[model samples]
Target: MDLASQIYERKSCRNYLDEEIDLDIIKDFISKCRPLNENINYYYEILTKDEVSVRTPWSAPYYLALYSEEKENYFENIGFVFQQVSLFLQSIGIGSCWVGMASPKKKKSNFVILIAFGKSEKMTRDRSSFKRKDLSKISDYEDERLVPAQLAPSAINSQPWFFKHSKDGFDVYQKKQNILKRQVFKNWNPIDMGIALAHLYVENEETFDFEIKNDFEELKGHTYTGSIKI
Candidate 1:
């Protein structure tokens, strides 16, 4: 299937079979996976259940642990890189889910996120099965280009991104976190923005120049994250 098809068909799988993935295939995927930013230092390890601590009830036989040297846009970098891995796994029939609620008990580096992957009981989902905010709700301009971005996954399905048309392309922002939610999601929201960016990149191979402009006016409850020039 094509990349667009993979974006629409991929779904998070919570239940996984107790089977080991082929080491060769895993290595090949690692070699082929691309990161959004090449300048940052990031590391990943394929781990078994015994190597990590997960408080959630969902379980998978194999997990991919991601770590990065703390730097600017580190969380977003993690999301950008792993979302590629997630989409690739779905494209090849392996099941994967972003395990943000879980963490490694032993810290070798700055653990950013974990992905659980293995044989899943159910492999794919129809495009209509996606539970996402409508395009009208997510974007200021009426363009199909933003549809894939609307479907980008987030922690607690927050769907925290907003977009407005600009002369060159678009300006991206994150919804202002209310007091009740800020304490829990301050870090995860930027990661969600990165996931949306990955979807946008897959939809259109355009260059994006990220910047923070506090003076840029935004929707009533949103804050500026960055911009993309088409």
Candidate 2:
């Protein structure tokens, strides 16, 4: 499958087989990742399991450690950038899972998140396996384009993304979570938004353009993330 098809087929894989992967293909793909928020400074390193320390019980042979300067939308930028890499990994039949509870053993102040990747039998999911909200639940109205975004994986499935459509494009937001959810996934929400947007980008590669705009109408109880024309 091509990159766009990977969006639909990709699964957040946890269970894996004892298999090997070619790192050179991953290295080349990482070099070419197109950042959704290009203004933010970010970097990543693919490290072995020995280099990472995890709070989760599951493990992988390799982990992709993402780091970025703590600036506006840094986490979001990291998500948008590396999620593309995740899709690329999927295209190559490698499996990966976003490891929010993990970090490098020698963690830097700039460290953001880890994506644990290895060869797995469960690389793709049937559409029935995808437990996602309908388009009406995520957007203000019907839009088939939002289907891929609907399928995006989020931390604990707290799919906190909202879109308000307009004639020009659509404005995206991070839906506000209550105190209970916020305590657990406050940082993950923005990254989730970026991951959702990454799916839209993969689907509409030629026309995806994102920018922060001040003029869009306010979305009640939601924080403005960005606007996109695609």
Candidate 3:
């Protein structure tokens, strides 16, 4: 399936079937793509058998452990890259959840994120409501069209970010906040924005026949600064 369909078809699958995924499945997926940034790597690493822990029953047999040494941008990258992985898994009929609320098994890195993978337990439509915003609500008509940017995922579903149109393409930005991060919450907003860019560009290309050109630029009232053009 295309990335945009994958993005829209993807949902947070908290309830998974009691199924285990082959290690090779995840390994092959990660091995194929290199992350855009070097300070961090984006792929699922097999933790020790003990690395899998949870209060509730986990659906997918495998859980991916996200790790990074970058103090300010690790989680951002996790959010960014994992979103892509999440959608990819969905494309293949695998269920996943961005398991930030669960207790992580490893503690060696400055930041960490996790996603539970498995076959999903079927649910009614009412139980699967992931109400996303429309194109008009996220940006103004003159505002470089940020409709696709709203598809991004954030901490506890708190998509704390913003977007602005630039002379070049579109500038994806974040909102600065004094909110506290647990020792585990090493800031990952920039990387998340990068993943967000992936979704925006992918969806735009498939649906609108547009492509994004990345050009770094600075803007006010936004967190990290990046751009992609059509």
TM-scores vs. true structure, each candidate: 0.89, 0.97, 0.73
Instruction: For residue 117, give model 1's deviation from the true position in Å.
Output: 0.8
lDDT of 2 at 59: 92
Using TM-score as the measure, the top candidate is 2
lDDT of each: 0.80, 0.87, 0.57
Q: Which residue pairs of candidate 3 clash?
A: 20-61, 60-117, 60-118, 75-188, 76-188, 76-192, 174-223, 213-229
Task: Give lDDT tens digits, candidate 2, residues 1-230.
Answer: 48888887788988877677899989888888888767778888889888999899889999999888887777788888888888988988899999999999986878888999999988997888888888898999979988889989999998999889977789998999988988888889888988998889888889999988878788788999989988
Between candidates 1 and 2, the TM-score winner: 2
Q: Please give the distance, in angstroms, between residue 108's alpha carbon in candidate 1 and its true position after superposition.
A: 2.4
Could you give candidate 3's per-residue lDDT for residues 51-123 as a string of tens digits?
6666666434667777666644455555655666777777777777766555456555444666777777542
Q: After best superposition, candidate 1 residue 187: deviation in angstroms?
A: 1.9
Ordered from best to worst lDDT, the candidate numbers read 2, 1, 3
User: Cα miss at 6, model 2 (Å)?
Assistant: 1.3
Query: Could you give candidate 1's per-residue lDDT for residues 1-230 as a string of tens digits?
Result: 35657788788899899987786776676676556567779888988888889988978888899888887677877887778777778877789988877877678758788888998979788888888888888888567878878888898999999899877778888898899899878888988888888777766654645554555765688877777754
Evaluation by TM-score, superior candidate among 1 and 3 = 1
